[model samples]
Target: MSIISLDSVCKSFGALKVADAITFEVREGEALGIIGPNGAGKSTLFNLITGNIAADSGTVHFLGEDVTRQSAMQRCLNGIGRSFQIPQPFGKMTVFENLLVAGSFGQGKSERAVEQAAADILDRTGLIGRANTVADSLSLLERKRLELARALATAPRLLLLDEIAGGLTEGECSQLVGTIKDIHATGTTIIWIEHVLHALTSVVERLLVLDFGKVIAVGEPAGIMARPQVREIYLGIEV
Candidate 1:
């Protein structure tokens, strides 16, 4: 089943059109990669779907229902969990506490349920060993894991990953990709917006190329990278 769908969605900031008639669907258990130059509306599209920013026009649907009018919290509870481009964790909170908060607030589960959920999420995101570590004291990689762990605490069927691999070393990127692949193997659908083409190509089967706030190409990863238009936009940046 298609878990999420966007039809003729449009959003703008003053004169800049962020998402221009954007339309796409994410099937259950599929990982989709979105690539484009900086400011190509990738993050904005995620915001539209997650209700962080409302679209000026068109529809946002989830699990076959129109959720265009839903608020961010509503969307989170409705199986849409997103990790931001920048890690957003409470500096003073322990890694475990952050996930517990997400489980209780975002999922509306009981304290015991939240505790179990947080533990499971930490295990899945490879943060169990550092569960008691304060968020501000963690390294960049651990911080990223906590970001994903917090999202997983919501038990989302569809996960939106925004630049989670950016600013990481090649080895670090490989480890993160492996972790993400493991998560996808367990059946969570993923929509990843990343500038690291190699990391994205390694994990995603299908690719969507956004340019100037529009989808220019959508196909198999290698085929999309080979497209002349995609090459032109990235200016020969190897994928």
Candidate 2:
């Protein structure tokens, strides 16, 4: 069964329809990449799934349970986690401290649990040596790693990644892609929203193309890119 499912979902903000009768599914351990134009409503779709905003219509099912009305915190507790487009680590805190806070606050873990979880996540995200470094003192790449580590501290089954590779050097993007691949290899399902086509293509087996609040294509990475509509809407600008 699919780990996550959205059926005929619809959401509108005033006259703007951000998601219009959208439908898709993410299978267990599947890495699904989402691409779209700047205003294609990709982030809005993420918000609807995570309960940042209520959908006007349709149902959202996560791990086979209806979560259309679940609060964001509830979703997190229920195994939904996300990293934002912008990294928001606690500047004054060390990388370890930031992750500890996520485990304690977001997952309600005990002190020992938080510490252990944070340590494990830091190792998994390749930030072990820099665990004591102040978050704000890190470079942009390290900051992004901290974001992923913080989300990992929550112990999610399915992770929603919003433009995690938006702004990074080529090498940094490649490194992040490998880290994300490792995370998925450990059985965490990932849905990544990324403008960097090459990075997404390297990590994800399946792809979904969103445009103007609708799913224009869903298939293999190359197939989606080959679609005329998708190319005209997103890939054109990319090339």
Per-model TM against the reference: 0.94, 0.92
Cα lDDT of model 1 by residue, 1-239, tens digit: 89998999999899999999998888889999998888889999899989999999999889999999999999999989999888889899999999888888888888687897689778867789999988999988888888888888888889999999888888878888998998899899999998888898889989999988898988899888777878988747554
Please estimate how well model 2 matches the true structure, expressed as its whole-model Cα lDDT. 0.89
> For residue 131, what is the lDDT in candidate 2?
96
Judged by lDDT against the true structure, how good is candidate 1?
A: 0.88
Candidate 2 residues 1-239, lDDT tens each? 79999999999999999999999999999999998888999989989988989999999999999999999999999999888777888999999999888898788778786798789889978899999999999987788888788888888899989887877888878888888998899999999999888999998999998988999989999888887888887876655
Count of clashes, each model: 0, 0
C-alpha lDDT of all candidate models, in order: 0.88, 0.89
How much is 239 displaced in model 2, in angstroms? 4.7
**Model 2: CA > 4 A from native:** 133-138, 237-239
